[model samples]
Target: MCGGHSRGHFGHHLPMGIPVSVPVEERRSSPVDVLNERLARGEITIEEYQRMRSVLDDQYRTKHSPHIRKPTTA
Candidate 1:
């Protein structure tokens, strides 16, 4: 008899599962952090920050909040 027979569907080795790889650029800079850094570095003025934040909010709603997106939407 086959004593060391493996179990489960061919590739289902780990019951807890494994992680999928993701791109680096897609995983950087949270909204608040981006705004804060820009503000701190004077890259954006207070008013501009506020305005960008509003747009960013809309972006966060539509997209997955990946830090940047196409400005002109059809």
Candidate 2:
């Protein structure tokens, strides 16, 4: 049960073909959302955005990967 944690979109209790169980047209923003919004506001350079994006991606994976790919027992 993975410590009874509910990761919403990342929950395994949901059906297949659904990434984390989020509905169509609805995707939660990563921690980089604020930075991304800033980028949209022309507050950051493309290179900086790309660089920060990579870092945030790494962070997201590190935090969520453990619970994301579970080994099923069948």
Candidate 3:
């Protein structure tokens, strides 16, 4: 069991033959949104949320910033 829900219970709701099409934006939430939700739910403290948000922001910056170049392998 996961999250107090049985695997079979989850499988029961899924359509076997039908293909489900959900937009990418609808299917996914940003990390910051998830963190905020957790904070609102009292799953994480404000301190934890701020720390994690900082880490996520740093990772995003490192990933998207062109000024930081990856070393080329010969």
Best by lDDT: 3
- Over 1-74, each residue of candidate 3 has an lDDT whose tens digit, in order, gives 56677786645566789767778777888899899989999999999999999999878988899698656899
Model 1: residues with Cα > 4 Å off, grouped in runs: 1-27, 63-74
Per-residue lDDT tens digits of candidate 2, residues 1-74? 46677566355665777655457458776568778888999999999999998888877786888567534699
TM-score rank order: 3, 2, 1
Descending-lDDT candidate ranking: 3, 1, 2
What ranges in model 3 sit over 4 Å off? Answer: 1-26, 66-74
Best by TM-score: 3
Question: Residue 45 CA error for candidate 2 (Å)?
Answer: 0.4
Give candidate 1's total backbone clashes. 0
Output the lDDT of residue 66, model 2: 55
Residue 22 accuracy (lDDT) in model 3: 78
Error of 3 at 14 (Å): 28
Going through the candidates in order, what is the number of backbone clashes in each?
Answer: 0, 2, 0
